[model samples]
Target: MLDARGLVIVFGLALGASACGGDDSSSGGGTGGASGSGGAVGGSGGGATGGTSGAGGGTGGASGSGGAGGGSGTGGSAGSGGAPCFDAKRLWFEDFETGDYSRWTSKTYDKNWNNGFCHDNGFSTAQANSPTHSHRSEITCADTQSHRGYGGLQFAGDSVVPAYTNQGSGIDAPNGVVNTYWSWLEAPYAFQNGKWFSFWTVNNDCGWKDNVITLGLEDTSNKLTPAHIKNTGGTVTFAPNAPGFPMGKWVRTTIYINYHEGVMVTWQDGTKVFEATFSRPDNDICQWHWGAYASGDNDDVVLYEDDNSIWKLGQKWTNFDVEPYFGVTQAVCSP
Candidate 1:
């Protein structure tokens, strides 16, 4: 079972070391103390550190969404309200409505990581249902479902000198804010029994949260199923999907993470698939990768993601792209 231990090691080994000459010594982007006021989003867990004060975008405007007050500061549990309000402001968005891969970044170009450039290809009937041009990602060479390839980009290599490898620049999330990633996604390929695909989310120091394993319990049907997990420290619980959850169709996936509140929520096509409130491996949530990850016979698998959006509550999310907009950085994993 790849638990938090494996993640700590992998992330530590890959990005924990001093990155030579990077913006920040850590694998993530430069950190500025978030300064904004979290509107009185009531929850008993009053730290209200919501990245608040003298700032550009944050402390977070987390309004009183959780029973007005339920948990401790920096950690929140489910309150009278099943969940917080969905009114968080949007941090970023992409519908491909423009029909161009603008701020969007991908690995399909890098060859070292299994034709990581396939996503760069023109629409493979990319949209299941879109009024405008859409794109899909196809990979035929990747055989493993373990660590991702960051689209053939390099992560923080083991360098003592602050290696300046820019993977998805400026995309890192600031501390103490409610950040969310939402997109319409579909896997058109037929389900391969036992084969798994995954994605990344902000958690345990804004590292990868494997959706494949955490999505569901073991089932005989071999389809996508998210698991239900609750916190050992807090009261928020996660609901897992059954072995027979729907697949092969476009589903809307929304992930919400509030580092200050220590809450994480996942929704599939509007249904809450998983939710958890956690506080461990201390540090604010940092970054996320838009990887339509797949495993086993990737040659035949294709993933469609469209209308991607980033939502930030209590503070507008930060942008991590460069001017003139050539491309963004991605954490290309070493093969």
Candidate 2:
């Protein structure tokens, strides 16, 4: 089993020391300490020290209904409250409404580590946010293997850094985010489980094994508590034991990463949950993985993801400027 330290070394070697710049060197950005102590909305985690909290957009208006023929796998017009199910212009998007797993493949860096997922059927037509189907991520603890799922772009060596440009410029680049959205639905577990569902990492071998910040939930006293994990030299847990990930319901999370400012802010179900400064603007985003990256303990786990999208604002902007476009405006769907 690859421990946290093992993973960090793997990533550091892959990306090289120079690619990472420096660790724990955050200047400016975090304010009012680390927020998200209470379980209430808008009170979740704060940004890194010296960095001010990028004010978050409030829970958007009412949830919009899915379009009449949104499952066609094509961009359709918005219904009442929701945006189109698909947008060809987006940097990338995956709704699984096509009833297949064609948009995903093995990890762009380490194919074997992906555990043969997405090669076969992994969709449930009944449980989805846009009506038809959603990707299902399952893990058998007895197998003692980690599970990983990919969405968005399959980033590679040369494709990483150049995907977005004009960092810190007040104008937008083609790949910069106007808003990026992803979500997870926790299926009822027969036993308590620890599962890391989202990972953004970089490495030289394209292995994506280092400096991973994971957003996942752990079952405590029969309730799932939200947590953001930073696994660099070791494992550090932020926003621990905070209540937000509700049981058996879809929790949509929005992420705003100011590559220019080296800051990241995350919101869950329209509430700000996590913010941090980890990488500099020069560091490239090597890989993005969403699934059971780390299967903690021996417990069966199942999760669902849908309506994953990356929408570029068409010009460069900071987290503070994009506050108006963040949060979950669509109606919450259940599994």
Candidate 3:
């Protein structure tokens, strides 16, 4: 069944969408639907009571408790025994299930320079991490310009998700607040033979109008390596210690930006890829955006994105074991 996080545990049943279908972290893991009000994955009949302080775990073993039924459940806890508890709220999430870009604040394409190649952006059903639809962007050729043919979405500031400041202590500080983005990406064979495809970037629209942090795929000498752009406009490319970016399949990616501390971390399929300190200190994370951009050389490059989410990690420094609020089963616990 689909829990409050809108995640479906495909044991043998169907799924349900969230009330704020366009922009909420409704994807989570569990069997029985949540019980009290907001609904968390409970054990037997229902799970914990929905409020600031959870009432009781469900009847069974896999129950957890959190405010407004927002906690993820494990094999034990809440009413049963030792399940973990977490509280999180969604800043933005676009599963592309609506089959359009209606959820985004704005859309951008190839920066007024039409290369005459096939720079396209839309929805696709070919492959999706969620189930039905996903955002697809394809580029056909290389660009000599710095900002090449790119098609993407812009997530500006809104009421539910306001701007955050990066002026706290260093990494892992107690006053740290993290803003994380989770998404599934796939590129069949575009990242081959020294081609670079920019999947997402956090740009500063307020002061310097520069990219504070950027992540992309760089095929250096035919070896797949993740690339990042520093706030000072310098490029740092390194191969992952673990398995590199795989071709022809979807991979889970997580980008964590600490607003309290000027630190950024990246993970691919639960493995740490890289970590860096933001050069631009005391910056505001209000106008940052993400997209798919093709640079260097390109030949029939295609990228697919599904089940994208932005979350506010209040006390959690990293996204590890926070909750299964994105349709995937995560280790249940308190952070």
Ranking of models by TM-score? 3, 2, 1
**Which segments of model 2 are wrong by more than 4 Å?**
1-89, 105-121, 149-152, 156-184, 187-210, 218-243, 296-298, 316-335
Judge candidate 3 at residue 56 and give its lDDT. Answer: 18
* Candidates 1 and 2 compared by lDDT, better number: 2
Tell me how candidate 1 scores on lDDT: 0.28
Cα error of candidate 1 at position 56, Å:
22
Q: Which candidate has the top score in TM-score?
A: 3
How should the candidates be ordered by lDDT, best one leading?
Answer: 3, 2, 1
RMSD of 1: 16.5
**Mind giving the per-residue lDDT tens digits that candidate 3 earns over 1-335?**
11111111101110111110000112111222111111111111100000000111221111112211122222123321333444433444455565433444332222222433434555566655555655555554544422232222222332211212221222222323232232333444644333455444443333223332445554432222223233233333333564466655676666556544555555566565555554444434433334444443454555565555444443464443232232233222332
| TM-score: the better of candidates 1 and 2 | 2
lDDT of 2 by residue, 31-61 (tens): 1101111000101121110001111112221
Output the lDDT of residue 88, model 3: 33
**Candidate 1 Cα errors over 4 Å, as ranges:** 1-87, 105-129, 141-194, 203-245, 296-299, 315-335
Cα displacement (angstroms), candidate 1, residue 65, comes to: 28
Model-by-model lDDT, in order? Answer: 0.28, 0.32, 0.35
